[model samples]
Target: MDKSLEKSLTLWLKQQQTVCAGYLKLTVLFGILTGLCLLAQAYTLASVLDGLIMQQLSLLTFYPELIALLSLTIFRALLAYAKESSGFIAGKKLRAQVRQTVLNKLISLGPSFINTKPAGTWANIVLEQIEDLHDFYAKYLPAMMLAGFIPLIILAAIVPINWLSAMILLVTAPLIPLFMVLVGMGAAEANRKNFSALQQLNGHFLDSLRGLRTLILFHRQQAEIDKIANVSNDVKQRTMSVLSLAFLSSAVLEFFAAISIAILAVYFGFSFLGHLEWGSFSLLPPTEHRLSLFSGLFVLLLAPEFYQPLKDLGTHYHAKAKAIGAAESLVTLLNIQDSSLTSHITTSLIASSKASHTKIDLKTWELEANNLKVFTHDGECLLGPISFTISGQQKLAVVGASGSGKTTLVNLLLGFLPYEGSLKIQGIEFNQLDLSHWRNNLAWLGQEPQLFHGTLMDNLRLGNQTLSTEKAWELLAKANIDDFVSQHPLGLKLSIGEQAAGISVGQAQRIALARALSRDANVFILDEPTASLDSASADAITQSLTKETTAKCLLIVTHKLSQLGAMDTILVLEKGQLNSSGSYDELMAQNGLFCQLNAQTAYDIDLQTSLGLNS
Candidate 1:
């Protein structure tokens, strides 16, 4: 019923032919061959019946006719196999291409794009929804063509023998497809709702699984179960509705096909009884009053075969309905990047650390932002108008209250969003730099270590395999994870869990720190690196990073506000604007937010006192 959904489906169907027409054409060829074979079988069977019954010929004399029928059946069977195999290959290739396009689109859009939708919805798009389109490509699309042509072939064979029967078959044929279109509209809508309900239910289930321990701790597991049950019931009802429409369409098709066949049968029967002769076509020099037994039997035999393609199409049409439902959602997701609202990217995703300083250009390691502003899709500025410049191996800390644009600024620096003003890196416009290469030159460590399931050494290299074992071991000692590694039998070869599941959170942060240090990066962006740990563990991580900061320009976005003795400059941000920029001593004298934050500092500020600012 939705015009937009119907329009999108039409456009999407047109796209499939261009992408895999070579494979899909084979499905059409085999389907037509099978139709020809069906007509041949009818003719052979009718001839054999006529010879034995009307001509009084012995079965042995008509053995060739019998053999022809058997051969046609065998040939049709082989064509059926080729048809099915070709259809499968067509669907498989199309799905592979669709999935690859989806993946590449997602990659270009990155995490900011992905986080907007439910994980389960994305999984459904990538897995279930694209997969649901197989039937459309493999069965429904081919059937669409065969249904049109195959019936015409049957009509061609029938018209010379009995035009009235062919007329009855042709006129009633449109009714099945006409009514099917009406039912299919409802089926498509129901399937869409069913897929939506499935996505929601799956998302809720995965969330519940992830939070099961917390749910049990709060004694809400049973309530969660009840909620899931209600959603599951919605999915069940939607599924039944779709099946009900499919059955209704089939019932309508069968009813019309039976009525059409019966009309032909009754005409042939009355003529045989010499009660009617008006409907029978005259094929001889003298007009025939009644039909011969052979002609009548042949037409009767081809009756079911006449409506067969339409019936086959009616069955496969459900696949079209299902694919329409899935394609509608997938089209929206696939078009996200092309949408005007999301495509403006202004900053570089990569940058060389300010201190590296080897490029030929002036201020090659400098970063400058003048009146820079970043607005979200909804037009609200998350970071703005604040400008700063950094050069040399300057260690700076950005301190702000919650919602003071710390995360937004980090994203802007990392080139996740578009900016409205001037941004320069290493004397080059930030927008002109290669983001991937710039990212390779910098190191980033977050609060929770991003550990995948692999050897400890692999996690340490962080996808760059050029780091030597000796360098990795040195970083391990610096981060205080060497003690644990030495105690373990595998050392760096020890397997870590996905997201550091096998290791404690404290130990995980240490490994992340070690990994960051091993990169020998020129600029390190450490964001809330100690947020999850206790005072002792936090102090240990802070101590480990301070010793490794001399050669690199380190930017820390932190709430700790402690140990400022080692910081060269700390910029205090209030809301989205810069409030103050000073050293620990200057800020303490200025009595700004930095001073108040330092006043509340709970960690031992002198824990890493020896690693003071050198520049």
Candidate 2:
């Protein structure tokens, strides 16, 4: 084996000591079985050969050897079956355990970690890489160890009969492994590259699929196809390179093993033809007696089996490398720190001595954002150094341009992201309040609602797992979606296609709104909650939202200028800073961006009507 390859394998094995040790024990047991089975099979062959050479081939006389050989063969098959079953089970157990550990960590890390990572890459890690470890842990590793050990045991047994034969086997045994290691080193590198390329391809494919509609609208369908093809081609080339390396490694190992066995055969044939004799050591002869002849033939029979494991072992190493590459990515992702401000918040619902300064009752929940400023990882500023407060039974509207950091501010308040300043509940700093308790008080409706593939009832019930059918129907009614949903033959039991496909955009939003209402939170943060609706639908939703806000702290983000008039307080944001905070009349009096933007919308409507463009 090349020195560098040997070093790499040793280092890799050491890092995986605990998991590898379990496989080692299994391999040891398998090795013992293999040795015993081979010895019995060879002994039976020797007995049959001895009888045949003497012209005494009687079934009755050879009955004991025949029966013993039959029993060993049966035992060997049983042992092999047990080993395979147990190894597969162990691999499965390890995969599940590792995947579970990573999943728990990812959940704690939450949205921030997810935002930074490509969803496709995470999916590949959890699904593909985790599954590949099965072959390496269950089959290849154990076989490799057994292959190495069994040969030595066979050599020990055969050495006393003919030192020359034993020497040849011992010396040639190293050659197969040496060739395997040299070839396998190149394969490992290729495998790592292939695995990386495959993950990138997956990420690109997912990204393209998610934006297919947008791409088609821009007349970029052909361009998207070209992009996908590029990624596919890269993956294909890497895969073929790895396969080629594996083929070459297998060929080299097989050739060496065959050549070594042929040389031994030649030596044995020459010795027999020349009538060679040993002048010394009656116990160890250069020429074969009946026992030596039987042992040599048996050794020859077992020779190929000794090298077969090494070949199989080298092939499995690629699977191990691929698994490790995936595992490494997952581990890094799971190691991400919970950088969210919510991490400091307690998870309990009940207010205690820690929350006393907030002056909130155990059942009361109020939220306040105090001069909170958020920045991206690259230090691009998001939300304000502006203060805001929303006490019970108040509705606040945050109006801004497309990129004016409205979502960032809401996320900060929700404790999904860390902030520069502080947020408090009922006058207490947000960090002191229980995050889980705080979350329980909220019903958030994002512009794009994510409805997982399932029945409508299934998706709705995800809001509160214990929600009764009666409660769900009531929520659907309140969200104004009950009429549309009930008209379908399947009603609440209808299965929504993946990500709520086969449903209107407005319906999807309302379904999510229904889920949020079903939770019965004391707080609601709606981001463009009426964006997908027509004027009449928007009016109905606004009325429902306004009624729901009577006893809760409501924070809605919108670009719809007319909705600002209904809010108790209208907070206008511009260039990542809060511009105005007051009633609509007060903001209009200031004649700032809010007034100008509203005026522009009014003019556009009037112009469209004059040109007969209004719907």
Candidate 3:
């Protein structure tokens, strides 16, 4: 990772601490209290040993000191427990807030933006990547501060007794963190590669599972399995490499701490034998030069405690690296700007609109577009600078060849794509109206029907839970699926699997249509509604849709010429531009793109009939 990027991620991680700042402070407080207790325990133990060995005191005479020592031990344990609990709470609150932030960002970007990435890649980011931040907040962050404060506290306690030992500890303290950083740089890079490999594996494995039937039909299941295996093995190797670095960091910390303590032990032994008497000083007797057992023992007892915090910091340094790797992906996703969405709507505008209870009359609603165009993120125009008009009860049909901007126009009207020119509804600019309110007044059905695992009533009432059973049945009847649903033993309660596993595609499409009708929307947009149905099913659906949408504005995109005869207007598009627009009979008489499309549709139908493929 670049140094600047790593610094930025570290800064970002620190900013999130504000959410649980109180808990983090409590954790640090408990840790400081625990360190203080350690110093008192060491002092008491050293005094008791000095009294017994030097002053020839009886062990039974020290009952109060012994009891005090035991009580301090129990109190320190409780403080340690509180510290752990506080850190855990901090981590839990931060993780929940970050996860919700990510979810809200994804929702705001909309489905068109989300569908560009694989489902498994998003799943990994939302689930596994967020989970990796737990330890950084819980352990590593608190330990970072404690590592500095606790060691200084120990040094403060020792400087009066033995300045040489204090200097020795202070000199070796920098080595542990210096080596930790050296090993951690590689560990962080390895973790980043590991996360990338895991994301790829997840996407590939899920895609294969979704298309398992197609793979089997094509006899490529074995090839897919081998590819998955190779990806999984790569992830394993990267994981092992990260662990190796983590262990090496721990080893380095321990080695430096051991060597520092050994040097202290050798100096204290020489002082006891009168070889280094200048380093030891007694405050009560200025003339005394001999080293006392109390000072030597106290410094030795506090030696391990001095290095404990640094060692713990080295151990948790890996967590910091792991969190940085995870944050790289999360920050990138949250930084994406959905330029197509109008986000500058003022709060006061929404407030005033709601206060006045503003509403538009559906019967007089009109949509007009002038020189409208759509461009990709890279500034490539995908749709035209064409013009059109739609009023209440108008039935318009958009017919064009593949990649002729049919879908792009529908997406623009649906508010999924940004436009360059004017698009107004009821004389109001489209971007000025509240998007949620505008969407509620429109109904849309795509080429593929989406149905969850539920009953007929559940699917139909998805948009309006308060819809009565009779009203649901009326919707199903309008979509011409009441008979099929009523024939099932469960009637409205009939069970279905995901994507309507127990029913045919035509039946699922009808249920989806009924669901859309339940919304009671003013405008209906259908894209290839009967594209996969047989002749009987297609005709039934077409007749029912035509009857139901007679009183509302309808925009249908289709290639079937049979459904075009009754349309009020037909738009013929050639390569992202509108070639012509007129009534069905008028376009047919023009002998242009519309006529050519009609001839091509008829020829394909005749060809299918001759090959017996239509059966």
TM-score list, all predictions? 0.87, 0.82, 0.89
* Residue-wise C-alpha lDDT for candidate 3, range 529-551, written one tens digit per residue: 87766656667777777788888
TM-score, cand. 1 vs. native: 0.87
User: Which stretches of model 2 miss by more than 4 angstroms?
Assistant: 1-24, 54-59, 111-120, 206-223, 274-291, 338-362, 365-394, 413-415, 418-441, 565-571, 578-589, 596-615
Model 1 segments more than 4 A misplaced:
278-289, 340-364, 377-380, 392-394, 426-432, 466-471, 518-523, 534-553, 563-569, 603-615
Candidate 2 lDDT tens digits, 1-615: 244653554454335435546755775586578677877788687767666664457767878888888888888888777778767766776677767766765554445446675778778777887676567667766766777777777777666666677778778878877777677665545665676787888888888898899999999999989988998999999988877877887788778888988987777666556554431123643243423455457667766765666666666666655555444455445433322223432231112334333324524656676667775533445666877777677789988888888887776656565456667666677656566666777789887788988999999988899988898888888888999888999989988988788898889988998898777787788888877765466667888888866767788987667756778898888878888888888888888998987887667657866886543
Sorting all predicted structures by TM-score, with the top scorer first, yields: 3, 1, 2
Q: Which ten residues in a row have the lowest lDDT in candidate 2?
A: 344-353
Candidate closer to the true structure by lDDT (higher is better), 2 or 3: 3
Candidate 1, RMSD to the unseen true structure: 5.3
How do the residues 183-218 of candidate 1 rate in per-residue lDDT, one tens digit apiece? 776787788888899899888887888788899999
Clashing pairs in 2: 346-434
Q: How many residue pairs clash in each candidate at the backbone level?
A: 2, 1, 0
